[model samples]
Target: MTFTRFVLSKRETTLTVVAGLLTLLGLAVVYSFPTWGGLGGMALFAAAIAVGGFPVARHAFRELWLSRSLGINTLMVVAVVGAAIIGEWAEAAIVVVLFSLGEALEEYSAERVHGALEGLLDLAPPVALEILPTGESRETPVERLAVGDRVLVRPGDRVSVDGVVRAGQSAVDQAPITGESIPVEKKPGDEVFAGTINTSGALEVEVTRLAADNTLSRMVVLVQEAQLRQAPVQRFIDRFARVYTPAVTGAAALVAVVPPLLFGQPFWGEQGWLMRALQMLVIACPCALVISTPVSLVSAMTNAASRGVLIKGGRYLEALSRVRAFAFDKTGTLTEGRPVVTDVVDVCTCGECPEDCGLQHAASVEAQSSHPLARALLAEAEARGIAVPGAQDVTLLSGRGIKGTVNGANVTIASHAHFDEYVPHEPSVCRQADELAAQGKTVILVQHDDEVCALFGVADTPRASSRQALAALRARGIHTVMLTGDSPTVAEEIGRHVGIDEVRARLLPEEKVSAVAALAEEYQIVAMVGDGVNDAPALAQADVGIAMGGAGSAQAMETADVVLMSDDLAQLPFIVQLSRQARRTVTVNIAFALGAKVVVFALVAAGLATLWMAIVADVGATLAVIVNGMRLRR
Candidate 1:
């Protein structure tokens, strides 16, 4: 029976176990065998080889079996057999051992970098409490809960369905889905998503979506599908090795066979032809070249994970390094995504007002709801410690604004159209608000007695360091672009503020994917950065997708190759630089390893290098390349 466990769970402990075994076995073998290859000599190999070997053997077998072991392992077995048949047992053992060790190192790197998807899965809402025939609640696995099923979401619980709050009010840490840094306030009729934390308060929710269709499940499905569909870039090297092994083996045979008989040289003489061929086989293992790229990528990725970034795999890391363009989603990515009041306007005041009546009126109207805007206004009023009086006949116009009577003042909070009946804007405030609106700010109108009394300004402003990150990317020659569902006025405004080279506004989710596809035609690589539900498709379509894990939408963050845990953009440019550095390091290692093998093979053939020297050249060069690639973990 197979007992499977995650590779990362046991690496340190597993390595320790293997090392102890290897130290004992190696010591026993050396002390018992042909001239004790040195107890001291076995120690280093026991430490490096044993620790490096098990991982490789496991990975190679897993991949071979997963891919069905069809032909990938065939050529390798053939190469090893050919060498051993010709009396090169030690060389064959080294070849197999080296290849296995290399495989493990690559796997080790991957294990280190993976995200806590399993832990995230633990956040799935348990049995959803459904309304029963007798007016009581019945518990069922979320999967059994169907659309239109009324469910109860308690305080400090995760919402299980995507729907509207039929009753009750509360603040939700939507950070689970939206990656918004702060909590979002929710009230009756406001849209709520599943897999989000119910920070405070409780509510009765009408299930508008089935459990399978809930936002959390959708994200899980999307992420899994994307991963399955992603092409395995590392497999190309394996395929290359299969073809490469036979050809190299044939060359070594020709070097050993044809030349000796024709030149009247003895097969096992002091300048033995058979011996030289064995040296060629030992040097031509190709383990170093095959393992180079995947190892460093795995190492850096694991290192990133320990710090909170969640990159998908080696291919994404490779693509990220080659990126020539970077596109950002405006809200909850570059910006905080927590809408806050920035300005205030007043009209219809009969005088004797201490504060901006527009501000007070707007705040008063906004005090009744928990939307980002509602919270923004409410917070501002509260910060000023403005006491709020409960309103009567409060009516919510979803996707618009709300209306009610606050202390018989007949107050209304609305959009631009709603304000036209009450107050008129001066050129300066109008112009300024228009400018601010263009930059992605949300503007609300506060009305009193059929006149626009004040304007409340709100926005999910950019992180203080985003502009600087954009500047750095531009300097690196990567084109920076922005995409969003926000109004053109807002998108363009955000684009301008963040110094984006292009802005595509009012895009639906599908439109964002099409946009990324279109851009891929001209750009070498496009990295998408987003924060929410709207950003999911775009995140999947881009050549390289980075999510702001801390403040991005749940879907966006989970699907991204690179996730910045701090919800800040300052980490972005640094990630880009590190990726480039990793790629460069890999290239250098490959060049050094391959270049050395080619030169040494040529020397051994020309009789310029002795067999002992050949062994040194092969092992020495491979060790150097391996050491060089390990530098990426730093």
Candidate 2:
């Protein structure tokens, strides 16, 4: 480490130790006044004041000169000097020692909160085994590795860059990047992130992102930026401290001068007005009150980040706790974005059709399309060992479906709504489509010329954890709503399966924004959850915006106020509980800090508190609030 860093690392400990030793030596000399003589003891007291008071004095001078403000350090220095002027050398030295120790403890507690980011920084390894073009591997620094460079990862080694698996297979532990407890199975085509551990088998990964641009690096930078952003309550306390500190200084001045000069009050005695004024200054420094909210917020944000939840700032963390309504986008937020073919029914009116004839026709027509539902149909056909011939003269029918020529027959596949509006279908087929839609499946009709042949039921089902997540939210009395562009029947069925309280379907992007605005008006604090691209407008409209599966998408990470690194709805309730607990911690810390100061001020006014007792109260309260804020790290 550099000399500057070394000194900074040890500065607080050095200050605390130096002040403590001086305090003990000064007290010993004062107690042995008869043995050392008055001159020697006074000289020792002067040395103690110079040594123990310099740090506090310098800070006070800098703040006064630069900011033109009287801060907590100013209060401490004034109180210490006043005690020294009153010839209370022992009290002055002890006050300086106790105050230094309190500052040291507060600094240490703040460092512990920041240590979470340091832990994240340590996760990515600096080196990787780069595979050259000749198929031989050589150890190289991660910074030298470029995009498309292949790296060989051994079992039990950390993946050095975010990449896709090009060869071999393994079960990679993604806890560092995604907070997932179970190791994920990685194959040749699967994407793996940097900082994940290759747990089981050796693999070769093709790098997609450079070392500096990796997911772990981005997370660390964003977390550092997040800690710098203050919450609403923290800003309020800071402003309050600006006014409160100067007011206390003026009050201390009044207590020192008014009673002694205007009335018959002692100026230099043990219970004199000046002594009471020094005690007031020591007790009402505002150190604890000023620090209470920010420390709690930083600790909470770091804790959330470590668990795969990137809360962008203290403002969002505080807002998340107050969210009364949660608006979720349907496609990629609540359900698996990939639809699967569930049921394939043969509805051929002509008896000449063979078994599985409807699926073959639908798959052949959909094979040319890249849409999710088309993929589902193709996958079903492939799984059944059915062959699909390439279609000719294929054309997309706008938003409805696709039409093509297959096996000398004109094959057309359209959505259920489009089929009802434009195609001539039998009542039995309509009833079958309605029954399938009621089960949360999207229905697509397979028509050959004027005759309907098949009905394919495709559905993007809810995630396994969706029902539990919604139930957890409901248990917390948070209303859940689903806003989607899907048809009303399918959206409501999916909503019912997931226990949503309200379902708003057939919503355009702008309509989703309006729904979010309405929810914000009624609920006061609404959170919009989505894939973060299509729902960006609504997400920005709500009080807090949460994006799902941020680990894969840079857009999601940049767009939302909070990003869940993994596609786990369970993390939603976890972050909610964490945010609420953090808010409660902030409240308790503020209350305790202020209450302690108030009680100490009362005791000082009654002349029952001395300089040592007042400094102890002030230092004790500051340490108490720091420790309380640090509890969120657990």
Candidate with top TM-score is 2
Mind sharing the TM-score for model 1? 0.66
Measured with C-alpha atoms, the lDDT of residue 617 in candidate 1 is: 68
What lDDT does each candidate get? 0.66, 0.87
Q: List the residue pairs that clash in candidate 2.
A: none
lDDT digits (tens) for residues 1-634 of candidate 2: 3323433578555755766776676666667776764556566666766776788888899989999999988999988888888888778878888887777677777767766687887788899999999999999999999999999999999998999999998999998888899999999999999899999999999999988989988888888888778889988998998998899899989999999899979988679999999999888888888889888888888888888889989999999999999999999889998899988989997998888888898888888889988999999999999988888888899979998988989988998889865568999999999999888788999988778999989999899889999999999989999999998888988998888999999999999999999998899999999998888999999999999988888899999999999999999999899999999999999999989988988997888998999889988999888888888877
**Candidate 1 residue-wise lDDT at 67:** 59
Which sections of candidate 1 miss by over 4 Å? Answer: 1-233, 346-349, 356-358, 396-401, 422-441, 448-453, 550-554, 608-612
Deviating ranges (above 4 Å) for candidate 2: 1-8, 28-45, 346-365, 381-427, 445-454
For candidate 1, lDDT tens digit of each residue in 27-119? 466566757555443454445344644454555467567755423233335444554465444444444454443444444534432333333
Q: Please give each candidate's TM-score.
A: 0.66, 0.91
TM-score of 2: 0.91
Full-model lDDT, candidate 1: 0.66
